[model samples]
Target chain A: MKPRIAFFDFACCEGCQLQVANLGEALLDVLKLVDVVEFREVMSEKWAGPLDIAVVEGSITTKEAVERIEKIRARSRILIAYGSCATIGGVNGMKNRSPLEEIRRTVYGEHAHTFPTIATRPVDQVVKVDYYVHGCPIWPPEFIEVLQAALQGVPCFPPDHAVCVECKLNENVCLYDKGVTCLGPVTRAGCNSWCTNNGNICYGCRGLVSNPNTKGAMDVLARYRIPLELVLNKMSMYNACREQGKTP
Target chain B: MRYVTIPADKMADYITALARRQKVVAPVEKGKGQFAFEPISEGREATLTYIPTILPPKKFFMPQYETLLEYDLHEGQKMQAVVELEEMVLFGVHTCDLAGIACLNTVFSDRPKDLNYLIRKNKIVIIGLECVAYCDEYASCALMNNHLPNGGYDLFLTPLGDRYIGHVNTYIGDSLVEEGGFFRDATGADFAALEEVRRRKREVFHDEVPIDLDEIPRIFAHSLRTTIWKEIGDRCLSCGNCTNVCPTCYCFDIVDKPNLDLKSGRRIRVWDSCQNERFAKIAGGESFRKERSSRKRHRFFRKFRYPVDRFGKFFCTGCGRCSRTCMARINLKETLAQLAREYV
Candidate 1:
């Protein structure tokens, strides 16, 4: 029997969920391997069952989002954190630095008294994640590869290198030399350095590499005479979860 | 003629002649203080006197993404190994990059040879340009013995007053000289000027590091567990920037891309880096070099230790790309000097 697959989203633009539909022709190949039982973004059918694979996108920013993700973890055999928001809390985690009550007041205004919101965190903080599909809007190639791996009952993961590896392979001129700061050295690779190849520096949407040398990264910034605050800002942009972990 | 001269004004004429017949690729200014190799339609677009391109000529030799085979699943695994080829003249190659290409040649030409690289390499004509002074402080060509012209290039051009002397090192170079129609037979006085320029260049370029060439391998052998690697690893983002910019670091990973129908797909090879934490990881998740310090040690040793033993010479061409591109500000020359201090 083909494994049942479902995609769920919360507190995000759902760009990562849209990547599934964006696969174009390759989506047909994916259809042959598994049945997509639920994807609210693309289809209308909301069949709920014991799912084989559940791909969750976005951060648990609200109490309601946390309950939904915990339910997802219980129903699915394998749960994947898809996109940076799901895996690392991404840009949503930036709110954690500010008080949640202030953010609620800013967004909801008079309704802020009724709506309950919490400090933003990844799905993993709320429930176990068997795999991760990382990026701002997840690279389509990796999404397909991971989906294929999961279907075959094979475990897969991202390359444990920094984005600098892919940037070099693409033969891009170093942004650092151009006096622009990038988080490539400490961030995990998998996006194939798309941001750098597109004439921008890496924003490190893929979170930090395992065993990251944070001290080394700061020293390097000092060597280039780049202000330490600039690096701190870059790190907090995507790796806010890691920063929170470091302190607490 | 083995040696020929092109008037300073006629340099463009030669590039135009080459461009008319085949694609002529050379360095072109990208932005402020940046340059890249690009195909030129006119001779004037080629910048002969520039620093090393952001990418080495290796882009043409072994492309970052090169298709190796195309397969169709519609039928019973029908497949065909393909080689992509295009004729071109590579102008303004540096001596250090020449040595880099030689290192790649030695690796790919070994027993289990790469036909794709070998076949494509022969399709391009190499014209080497000599660097009179250091391109920047990052270069250490003097230490790698690549400051002087090596034999990898078919034509070696040296800048002389009023004209450029082109050494027709191969038959192909000889043919180009004859075809261009602007070159004149190099007089004996012209050769003397070439010798004088080279003699002066030796004074200008010297070993950028404190260590001797022969002692590099020995130093690496002794410094296996030194804190120097730990020091470097600490500052390393493990971004693999150093390995990626390295001219001789040719490790690669293969990937396959399928068409929408999933009936057909192409397999290609992209460059990989050893400094990556997972480069040596196995199926069982047993990583031989899991620590950042060990990965850094492996990278340094590859250039100085393993290649010297296998290929009978150091793999590093001293192009300085690794140092220049490193986001962590890890200077290759400084690292070598420190290792030398520890070894001695």
Candidate 2:
């Protein structure tokens, strides 16, 4: 039987789901391998049954989000964290850098009391995540590769190396050589060094590697005369949750 | 085996002749003060004097990504070994990169040879361009002994006052110059001019780093537990930028990508780095080099100490690409000088 797959979104722009749509011709190939029982972004009929794979997007930002994800874990055999929010709390976690009350007051204004809020976290904080397809918006190549691996019973994961591996492969002039400070060395490799190739420095939107050398990252920033507060702030975007010793 | 001259005025004609002779690939300005190895049809297009390219000539020899095998899963994991190669003449390669290519050849050609790299290597011809002086302050070519040509090319070009001398090292090099109809036998005066340039270059290209070349291995061996590693480790982003820019760092990992049918796939080898946490990880979820400092230490040792013992030569070609590309500003020369001070 074809494996039943579902994609769920919580508190995100759903750009990651758009990435799946952006797969273009490859989407046909993806469809051939699995049954998309549920995907609110693409489908109207929601499948309510045991799912072989549940791909979750966005961070658990509310009490309701936490409860909905609990039910997703109960019905799915394997739960894959999809995109940066689901994998590392992503830009959604930027709110975490500030006090909860301040964040609520800033966003909800006087109605802050009516809505509930919580510290942003990845899916793993609430339930076990079998795997993660990570990025600001999920990387299409990785998503397809992971899908293939699950169908073929192959072990699928991102390279343990940093983004510099792909950047070097592209033979791009280093950002540092141009006097631009980049974060490619410490960021994970699955995005294929896209930002660096396009002439911008890595913002580490995909999150830090499994075992990030935070100290090493700091030393590099310090050498460039970048302030520690700035580096910490940049890291706080996707790393606020992970730096606190959480997993996805 | 022989030296000849390509008149300075006819350099453009010489490059055009080389183009007609074979597939010509040389350095061209990539705009905004950047340069890369690209195909050229005219000498004017080639930037003979420039900073080190973002990537070494290693890309032509062992591409960023190369397919190692093709597999069919339906027939119980049937696989076919494959290699990709093309013919071309690489011109304007710097001396440091020439030494780097030689190091890669030694490593990939040893015992369990990497036929993929070997097969791709032989299809291309190498022509090196001399660096009259240092390319930039970030280089340590003198310490690594790569500032001078060491015979890794079919032909080596040295710029003289008004003429360029070609040191033909192989029969292919001889034919290229002899048949090109642009080069003639170099005179005794040309030899004297070449000698003069080398004599003056000795003063210009000083040991960028304070450490002696001979003491590098010993210094690394003794400083295994130094606090320097801890300091660099603490500051390092573990971005692996240093390894990617390094001409001699050639670690890689393999993966398979299935086709549309999901039954057939191609296995490819992509570049890997020791700075990564998982590079040393095993099946038991235990990583031996868990600390960033240890990974940085391994990369340093691989270039300076380990390769010297195993390959009888230092893997570092002193290209300075690593330090230049380092976002964290981990200057290679400064690091070596620090090592020298710690153990000298």
Candidate 3:
């Protein structure tokens, strides 16, 4: 029997859902391979039943989102954190720097009395996620590959290697070699170093590799005469998942 | 040891003959000192004596944009895993680049083998050329222990006076010698000439940086709080030139590009750099390395410290491409020296 699949969203840009639509024919094929019983972006048809796989996109920023995820987790055999938002708290987590009340007051002003908010967190922070498809808008191929692996009953894990491995394979010169600093060394592999190919630098949208030596990275920047505060800030981004309350 | 004397006259015939029998690629001059590896039908176009090519021979084994899989959405999302590879002979590879290929071999051949890279690599044969001296100031091969031939080639060639001393390293190389009809047994004088070249190379290539190799990780470890990162980060535009030119900087981003019909698409793994502002930022708006200094520092440690712990070797081949190509004038040698001074 085809595996049942579902998609859920909480606080996000909805780009990850749109990215799935961008899959085009691949989406149709995926639909055939699995029963996509609950994707709000593509179809209005909804089902309330146990799902074989649940792909959760976006981060949890409110009490409702937290309660919704728990329900989804209880009904699904496997839960996948899709996109940077669902897996690493993503950009929305940036609001975590400010107190929840302060954030509401800053954005909603007079309406702050009615607005409810909480510190943003990836789905994995609250509920167990069986897998993760990482990226700003998770790459479609990786999403498909993970689905295929699930169908085969094989666990798919993201590669733990750094981006420099792929960059060297592509034969592009290093940004640091060009007197610019880069984060390819500590960032996880799998993106194939796309930005670097087009003469741009890596933004580490996929997050840090397993056991990344962030301090070591800082030392290298220091050697190059880059400022400590700048290095600290760069590392602080998306790292709220790893560093919840620590400064530096 | 075999000594082969191909007069400048019969060189093209020999090259053409090799091309016909096997896939033969050689370095062709592309103006100035720049060279590229292209299919060679004749010897005249081959730059036998050239610096490291702009793109190393790694391209043949792992094409920049080779398709690893193809998918069709028309029928239930069907997909086929594929590898586009060509069997070829890569001729005249510099020692440093050959070492770089060796590094790649160790990586792809590791557990969870990259079948695409492995299979394609097996189809090609390597013929290494000895670099008697430095390719340019950008090369720090001497510091990295890659200045001399470390045997990643099937056929190793060393220029010996009027002739070439060819060391056939594999059965395939032996077959080429047997079929080419241009080789003669090596004489004592040929061996002497090869030895003399080696002796001269030692004198020509000196350590570019004064720090010892073992001291690199320690220096970086001790100097984590140094102000060097701030200076470099302030000046760096984060253009990613340094990682692009680096011999080993390999971060990537994977994307799915669907056809207009929206039925099928190919998953592409594109090169990515960490210098970009958004590299570590998540969709929720959080950034791991938000400042240029942190990103800049991350790049440095990857080369000097991180890889040393993981791969048991420095990822930096001392190929000064990063320093040479930097728009911000962030000299790698200068950075290392400063770290040495501050941390040592």
Candidate 4:
């Protein structure tokens, strides 16, 4: 029997789901391998229970998000975090760097009291993540590879190296040498060094590598005369939850 | 003939002639003090006086990505072994890069030989260029003894004041200059000029590091438990830049890319690096080289120690790309000097 796959979104921009939709011609191939029982973005019918695979996107930003994700985990045989938000809390976690009350007041203005907020946490913090497809909007190639691996009943490990590996393979001149401060040295790869290849600096949107040498990255920044606070602020853009080391 | 000469003015014509027959790859400036090996149709496009290109000539041989096989699942897993080959003349290659190519040849040609690399390597011709002066501060070619050519190329060129003296090492090199009609027999005066350049080169180039070359393996062997690994590791970003830019470091990973049909795909070999955290990991969830320090130590050992035991040769060509490309500013020569101080 073909494996049943479902994609769920919580509190994200939904760009990751769009990446799957934007698969273009390859989406036909993906359909041949599995049955898409539930995809709210594309179809109306939702599967009730007993899902073969559940791919989740976005962070748990509210109490309701936590409860929904846990319920989804209970019915799925394998749960894969499908983006930076689901795996590392993503840019949504930047609210965690500042006080929740201040963030709520700034965004909601006078209606701050009417809305309740919670510290952003990755899906893995609330429920076990069987696999991870990591990036800002999720690199489509990795998503397909992870799905294929899940169907084959094998583990698909992402490249645990830094983005500089892919950047060098592309033979792009080092951005640091171009007077640009980049987080490519410590940020996890699997995006094919996309930002750096396009001449933009790495903001560490993929989060730090498994064994990031942060001190070494800091020294590199210092050599380029880039300030520590500047890098810290950039890191918080997608990594405030991981950096804080808070237990849910 | 053992020696020939090409006047400085006629180099462009010779280059254009060679490009007419096949691809000619040479160094070209990429601005901001960087250069890369690119195909050129004119001699002026080749930067003959440039430093080592950002990536060595390895890209033409092994390439970053090469398809090994194509598979179709419609026939119950039918696969065809494939090799992508290119025929070309690699021009203006520095001696350090030549040594690097030689190191790769030894590795790929070893037991359980890689037919993919060997098959592709045979199609290209290598033309070497001598470096009479140091390229920059990062180079340790003199220390590694790779500054001088050691039988890795078909032809070698040494720049003189008004001309280049060429040493033809193979019949292919002989016929190239002969058929092109751009070179002439070297005269006695030309030989004297070449001798003068070599004589002065001895004075200009010396070991950049203080330690002797023979002591390197010994020092590395004893320093396995030393603090240098931690010191270097503390500054290493594990970015894999050092390995990717390294001319002699050749590790790779194999992956399959399926087409939109899901039944057809190509298996490709892509370059991998030891500096990656999972490079040493096994399927049992135990990674022997889990620490950043251990991975960094493994890189150094691969170049200085393990290759020596396995191949009886040092894999380091002293091209200095590792130090130059390192974001952490970890200098290879300085690290060697520290090792010499502690373990020599």
Candidate 5:
């Protein structure tokens, strides 16, 4: 029987969902292996029945999101948290850095106190996630690999090393040499050093590795004479939740 | 052994002749003091005098990504082993890089031979260029005893003022010299110029690190539990950049990439690094080198101790790529000198 797969989002840019949609001809090939029962972005069809696999694509930032993600966990056999938002709370987690009231006033202005929000938490923090497709907007190749593994009942391994590995393999000149402070030395791999390839330093959108050498990363900053506040500010963008002891 | 000389003016013609015979990969400046081994159709594109390319010529022998086998599910697990290769001439390889290739050759050519690497290595010809002076402060080639040509190339070129003294090491080099017709018989004057160049180089290059090459293994043996690893590990980002750019580091991981149909896939080998957390991870979720310091120590031992014990030679060719490419500025010479001070 084809696995009944569904994609859901809570607090995200929906760019990861667009990546799946932008799979071009590969999406049709993937359809033959699994039955995508509910993909709100690409289809109008929605299934409330039990799903074999549920691919969630955002951080849980609201009280309703916490409840909905638990329901997803209860219904699906395998749950995948994709993108930086779904897996690591992403930029949404940056909200937790400042006072909630002040942030609301800044964004909603007069509409403050009307919108109820909670600290951003990853899908894994709410419920168990069986697999992960990590990146800001997921790399399409990794998405396919993760999907294949999910379908075959096998485990897919994401690179636990730093982004510099892939960056070096791509033969791109080290960003540090170009006077750019990159978070690649501590950032998790699997994005294939996407940012560095395009002549941009890594902002660590995929989040830091499982066991990052943060001290070493700081040493790199010091070696290049880059300011600590600059890198720390960049780190807070997608990793504030992880830093604040929200998720493991 | 045959000797030939190519005048400075005909250097371009010599390279053009080589390119005309086959695909030629030579150093081309990438601006901002960076150079890369790129294919050039014209002789003028080859930058003979430059520091080491970002990646060594190991890219040609054992490519970063190499497909090992193509399997098809249609015929009940039909598989065909294959090796991707090209016939070409590699030019402007420095002595340090040539030593790096020699180390790789020793590894892949060892018992339980990697037929794929062996097959591809034979297809390419090597032309080495002597480094008259030190590339930079990062290089420790003198310490590694790789500053002089150790004969990993078919033809070795030594620049002496207006002409290049070429040492033809093999039949291939002799045939090239004869076929290209750009080289003339090496006169006694040219020989004196070559000797003078070598003499001058001897004075220029010296052990950058304070330790002797012979004492490296002894120091490494005793310094296994030294605090230097911890100190370096504290600064090492576990980025795997050090090993990736290393010429002698040949570790790789094999993976199967199934096509969209999920019917068949091609199994390929891609470069892997020991510094990676998962590099030492086992099936039951146990990582041998769990601590960053241990992984850091392992890399040092691989270069200094383990390879010397196994291969009877230091795996480190001292190209200084590991130091040069390190994001954390973990200087190889500094590390080695510290070890020597502690244990020697």
Candidate 6:
């Protein structure tokens, strides 16, 4: 029997769903591999029943999102965080910079009374997430691979190694060696050093590696002559989930 | 075993003959002491003594951009895994680059082997050239223990006065000798000549930096909290040149390039750098090492500390490419010295 697959979204750009569609023909292959009973982005028919796999995107910000996620969790056997927002609180977590009330007032003013809000957090914060396909816009190959693994009844976890491993394999000159700073060492792999391959530095989108040598990455940047505060600010961009203590 | 002489005059004959039989690539002068590995049909095009090429021979094993799979949307998501490879004799490879190749071999050959890389690697033949002296002030091969031939090649050649002393390492190399007739077995005298070359190399290739290789990881370990990263991060433009030029840096990104028809595309693996700002950013916009200092520290630990713990060896290889290519004037020796000073 084909595994029942569903996709859920919370407070996000819904870009992860677009990225899934970007998979083009691979999307068809994935549909053949599993029964996607509930992807709002692609399907009109909605299945309000139990699911074998639920791919949840975006971060939770309102009470409704939390309750909705709980419902999805109760019905799904496996929950896969579909993007950085659903897994790591993502850029949405940046709102943690201010108190929840102040942020609401800043955005809504008098209208704030009508809108309910909460600190944004990844889906895993509210429910048990069985797997994660991490990235700003989920890497299609990784998403497909993890989906295939799930279908095969194998546990699929994001790679724990740093980007340096893949960078060394590509044998490109180090950005630091060129007197530039990079986040390859602390950032998780699986994005396969995407930005770096195109002559851009790693922005740490895949999230931090498990037990990353944060101090070590700091020293190398210093040796390369990067400023400490700028580096901190850079790290703070996508790390609001870990910083705000919202990560499960 | 006998030491035979083929005068320098007949060098072209041997090279042309080799090229005719199979593909031959050698370091050719690009300009101003700079050289690159280019296809060579004759010996005159080969630069026997050259600095590390603009790009290491790693390009042969893993091209900057390679297609791992080709897919067609016209026929129900049909895809074919393809490998573009050419059988060639890579001649004039320096000892340091050979060591670089060995590092790559260790990586791609690991579990879940990269079939794309392995299949391409099998088609190429390595012929290493000995470095009698320092290539430049940037090289620290002696400290890294990559100055001498370390058996990554099938044949190693040492220049001996008017001729070359060739060490055939594999059966394939032996077959080349049997077919080419340009090489003869080495005698005791030739072996002695090789030893003399080694003795001379010891005098020429002293440690470029004063720090001990074994203590490097420790120095980096203890100096993590030091202000060196802050200093370097201040100047870092986040250009990612250092990772791009590094001999062992192999981070990559995979993407599918769809055709104009939007029906067919290929999954390409391209060279990636960790120095970029977006490398770690995931959907929803969370970045791990956002600081330049953190990213900088990560690169150093990867070269000096992390790999040592994981692979039981330093990943730096001391090729000096990173230092030479850095636009920020980041000196590897100075960085190491500063770390050593702070730790000690």
Best by DockQ: 5
How does candidate 2 fare on TM-score?
0.92
What range of 10 consecutive residues in model 1 chain B has the weakest lDDT sum?
B256-265
Best by lDDT: 5
Per-residue lDDT of model 2, residues A67-173, tens digit only: 99999899998888889888888888888888999999999999999988999888888888888888888878889888777777667776666787777777777
- Model 1 has a clash total of 1
Residue A182: error of model 4 in Å?
Answer: 0.5
lDDT of 4 by residue, B266-333 (tens): 99999998888878889886989877788888889999999999999999999989898887888999
Per-prediction TM-score to the true structure, in the order listed: 0.91, 0.92, 0.60, 0.93, 0.96, 0.63
Best by TM-score: 5
Give candidate 2 misplaced runs (Cα > 4 Å).
A99-102, A177-181, A243-245, B20-22, B30-34, B178-180, B210-212
lDDT of 5 by residue, A88-144 (tens): 989999999989989889999999888989888888888998899988889999999
Cα lDDT tens digits, model 1, A176-217, are: 778888887777888989899999888889888877887877
lDDT of 4 at B178: 84
Of candidates 4 and 2, the better by TM-score: 4
Ranking by lDDT: 5, 4, 1, 2, 6, 3
Q: Is candidate 1 or candidate 4 better by lDDT?
A: 4
Residues B191-213 of candidate 5: C-alpha lDDT, one tens digit per residue: 99888988988898886888788
Candidate 2, residue A22: lDDT:
86
Off by over 4 Å in 4: A37-50, A244-248, B41-43, B178-180, B258-264
Report the Cα lDDT for residue B339, model 2.
Answer: 90
Location of the lowest summed lDDT over 10 successive residues in candidate 3 chain A:
A239-248
Q: Candidate 2 — what's its lDDT?
A: 0.84
CA lDDT, candidate 4, residue B132: 84
**DockQ for each candidate?**
0.55, 0.58, 0.04, 0.63, 0.72, 0.03
Residue-level lDDT tens digits of model 2 in B48-74: 778888778887887778899999989
- Candidate 3 lands at a TM-score of 0.60
Q: List where candidate 1 sits over 4 angstroms from the true fold.
A: A1-5, A19-38, A50-53, A73-78, A99-110, A151-153, A243-248, B72-79, B258-264
